[model samples]
Target: MACLVRSLCDSQPVARFQRRCGLFPAGGAAGEQYVVKNYFYYYLFTISAAMGQEVFYITFLPFTYWNINPYVARRLIIMWSIVMYIGQVSKDLLKWPRPCSPPVVKLEKRTTAEYGMPSTHAMAATAISFTFVAVTVNQYKYPLELGLMGAFLFSTLVGLSRIYTGMHTLLDVIVGSLISALLTALVYPTWDLIDHLMLNSPLCPAFCIVVPLLLCYNYPKLNHYSPTRADTTTILGAGAGATIGFWINNRYISDALAEAATHHVLSVSGEMLLTMLAKFLVGIGVLVITRQIIKNLALKSLCSWYKVSINDHKALQQFRIEVPYKFITYSSIGLNSTVLVPLLHKLLGLN
Candidate 1:
């Protein structure tokens, strides 16, 4: 087990695996002194990275399913998508290089090929932990002191991990944490107002869809290379999906599910557990299939319409075809998670 952990912690093996997963650049400059060779730091940063992963957040969905109140789930999904979009945009606009091997420490799992300013990992950790604690304290009447303590500890570890691994400068982590805190403070109070407007306004869908696309279109031009196009498309697609799904849920699903829950007696723990398991299985399957189909179709259609060959990597990147493709795919995922998945639950008599 120790050997396996060491092997997995090795930079070359982990980096190669990440590259094959299409999550990192194929090659990057390497250096000896700057690399985090200490096994202890390697494991720590690896765990830290996993904590900040999108998949970890997705696990909260099942809890929402069990509770029958998706308020927290929806908020988390929307907040994460927006935060990532903002972080990626800022990184691209700044176009700052990450801590390279010669001058600074380089860590393993350096998958993202984007600029390093205001570390997204730090931002995401702070945003998620802070938002979760805030919601729990405000809505659920949980103890504020305990929530704040836990959140502070988690966010601190995540921020420290970035610096320890040499993935970001101290300033980057500080800025990232501050940005997340500021955004949370501003958005939390206004979310209800925004949610009302989005649900009621006819222009909600159009606004949500168009605004993100416009943001992508107007992204700052940078001479140096960055994953600007890919990152923009990912968030835009997710934002669009979440927007459409939220609208659909407000129109069709939320009230019905609430009514059904009130009408029916709560199930026993065993039954509830089984239902949750089934819901997760079904929901994940549908989401995976929907994402794959939409991504393929969107890419093919966009390539043909732009009169660019799919194989022309340079043209695709230059024209930002990834924007539309990711938009369609993530939108489907968002829609599936909110609208279709609940409807399926109802059909299956799980809710």
Candidate 2:
């Protein structure tokens, strides 16, 4: 990724520095080539956050406001924090210099970057977008196609911002977005499972063992497919439910969290835990009253939004399903799922 970015910086749309002979230093780059390069990289940087802000704001946060709950909020916030932390670590571990000055991007000022691969903004934004949408749709209900489009727009603009500000090469931002997104995707759900284990270990083993079996039992009658297909559908269903749950929780936090911020008597950790616990209580209550629509919604329903059939084995790996993106998925799942699920079994928390 770094090499690709360097190549881009050196080759196409190269931003000429001050010729190492300028009388005064410049804060921004100048020239159309540099502008293009930066814009491309910036787009890479802002993706997840951009997508997250839209889904979370329009779907999750507003819905939470209308409902007025906080347990979901706390969990969502913690998860978001996790995603943010992952982005930070990835940035440093990757240790690419900022493509440019990391400026407040504008139309002009094509600043050159020092290290430009894997734009942090892109990673963070993408994480936020996925986590927010994950929580929202997983938890509540929303228009699907329109929602995805909106998320895409937000992420795209964020990526563009990187370039407009001359903060990264196109390759840098693109690679960054992909790296962050892929990494997050692989990790978060596993995190949720780990959380579930730590919080509810005894039941987790049974739950993990049973859900798939039960899903297998009903696999044929519910949809009637082969083991491979049945397994795929079940996996999709669980994922869909998790995403929905994630969204419901995230939406509540994005808006109401600010209010919780006002009640900042405790440290960040205390406040987060207390607030999240409160949210969990609220979610439980809501589940009781709504007959657990948010809690029980099927991935089949979610799949309908994307025109994915429950039995479509290819879709799980191929289609752009709107999975609920929580912060834990970015951090915990990244670490836990692959290591355990492949070797032992997979369970769930909020992934």
Candidate 3:
């Protein structure tokens, strides 16, 4: 099983990087790719792959915000936005392709058609895990070694899972992890400063809103269509929403312990555990309802405004339509997660 997985993952297609450097052979084929037939490893790897995906992110970030610490969540989302944007743009600029089918069977198809280098899965996994550790290392009374170990394990699992799913080569995984590490190192010094500015600076909201939208609008174009741009918009929109929401929570909502919330660890015991569970359930319910309603309303409104049929798939993909709808829908979810849901918790005695 190990050798089969290895053979499959190690096989590389001659993408732009390989073509220029003459690193990998150009003769690989989709038919020659090896598939994971064992049930145990297949399920394990599939679950690992999910860790770096959209569903995991949507749930994970909000869970941190509502249950853990908003200060940590805020920084995590910001780092995620930065790392993912750079990773996505790099993939398009580098123009790499996934491993060929014959030697590396791709179990997933949704992202297979997209360029694959410095895998975003690896980038996100590294960023989220290490960023969490970085933010909490000094704030909480936890074992630094334990936190580092957990981060490493989480990052390694997700990175290796990319290869197991045949979505990335070893090189892609390595580069992705390295890039995220470099980014985190570069940004960690300014974390305290950034946090201060975000929570206290009156101008932070406008900066957050304008910068991400501009990044989304000016995202690099690909020769052929890819989900990269739309995905980037979703990420940026969520980040912007979360940032502004943080600002609102601090500046106007003025919860007394708002700034001091990150000073300690959240203890989970009997009734506390139950309350946390309830909070997650109720909070997530509100978020889901918000997402569905806003997504539908935004899509329909944009479609109407553009005089495009709501059912027109290609028309909906147009820059004006897609960007606004995705941006609006996710931004609403982000805001609701950080601001509205917490207020609801306080009102409902979930706090």
After TM-score superposition, what is the CA distance of residue 181 in candidate 3 from its true location, in Å? Answer: 0.3
Compared with the true structure, model 2 gives a TM-score of 0.38
lDDT of 1 by residue, 44-88 (tens): 656776666556554554345335456555566557767777888
What tens digits encode model 3's per-residue C-alpha lDDT throughout 291-351?
A: 8999999988888888989899888877888888889988988888888888888888987
2 or 3, which is superior by lDDT?
3
Steric clashes per prediction: 2, 52, 10
Per-candidate Cα lDDT values, in order, are: 0.67, 0.41, 0.82
Which segments of candidate 3 are over 4 A away from where they belong?
1-36, 262-266
Instruction: List runs of model 2 lying over 4 Å from the truth.
Output: 1-7, 10-79, 100-115, 191-351
Kindly report which residue pairs in candidate 1 clash with one another.
237-327, 241-331
Provide C-alpha RMSD values for all models, in order: 8.1, 18.8, 5.9
RMSD of candidate 3 to the truth, in angstroms, is 5.9
Cα error, residue 188 of model 2, in Å, equals 4.6
TM-score of 3: 0.89
Ranking of all predicted structures according to lDDT, beginning with the best and ending with the worst: 3, 1, 2
Ten-residue segment with the worst summed lDDT in candidate 2? 337-346
Tens digits of per-residue lDDT, candidate 2, 1-351, equal 987546665423323321211112235453333223343344443443344332332234323422333333333433444444344334434555544432222323322322345665566556555655554554445666666777667666676556544555666667657765676576666755644443334454345335533443332221221122222332333332333333333343233322222221233467656654554344334423432343234345556777877577556433233222111122222222112221221122311
Model 1, backbone clash pairs (residues 3+ apart or across chains), number: 2
